[model samples]
Target: MRTRTTTAALIVAGLLLTLTACGEDDTAAKPSAPPSLTDEQRSSARAAAGLPPEPSTTARYKFLEALNDIDRRIVDGKDDKAVSRGLNQCSSIKRASGDEDKQVELVKQTLSRFTIDTRLPDIATPETGGEILAAVHQNLCPDF
Candidate 1:
């Protein structure tokens, strides 16, 4: 009886182990790429705002870097070079707006239209493009 019981226990343990191993996979989940606006989408957004489309990846990175800086500044309460870089990038948008507050508002609305909620730097939850754009405008365009 003892031998039979021991054998039964061993069999159960082995079966459990096999089942667990079978369900397990060695592959890791791939990280999703950052969401960005398409050229047409950007162009449409710009047109809606009465501004030209901003399609430069370099500008995109600068915008992202500025977002990063703005995020950092919010926490640390100090300005940095990223602030300037980001403002400089927005200058084109400002120029397109013809120095009117409505232009900035239009750009912001357009950004909101195109922005998606995804993993953004320093944000615990997914952030939107409008949120980032607002941050830049709020921080740099004080008059607006």
Candidate 2:
């Protein structure tokens, strides 16, 4: 009886393990790239804002760096570099308007103490890495 019970238990356990293993795939893929915003969408946003269109990523990053400097100034209770940087960031946005351009403006306004608040849509939840991480997430991360 003991032997039969042990065999039954082992067989049931083996079957369950096989079923679980069968459900997963080692070849499961990562997500595909997100869709790019359409040119019409970009054009409409630019028209509404009376701005030009999107600038290069490099220009965007430099502007974001300047904006973050503004935040550091705020934390120090003095609006020094942040104001300058934030305004510079906004200047960079003058030639662009769309999702990406909107994001650029959001960064500028956030650090510039504007009445109209805007934030980037896809910010990764903040951790303790400090300003550099914040900048990278804001500037480099897609849609950040």
Residue-level lDDT tens digits of model 1 in 1-144: 999999999999999999999788756765778889897987787566544343345554555565665354332332334444344435545655555665556444433332222223234322334455566555444332
lDDT of 2 at 130: 30
Model 1 lDDT vs. the true structure? Answer: 0.51
- C-alpha lDDT values of all predictions: 0.51, 0.47
What candidate 2 gets wrong by more than 4 Å, as runs, is 1-35, 46-52, 56-144
User: Model 2 over residues 88-127: C-alpha lDDT tens digits?
Assistant: 3443444443567565444545433432223332321122
Error of 1 at 51 (Å): 17
The count of residue-pair clashes in candidate 2 stands at: 2
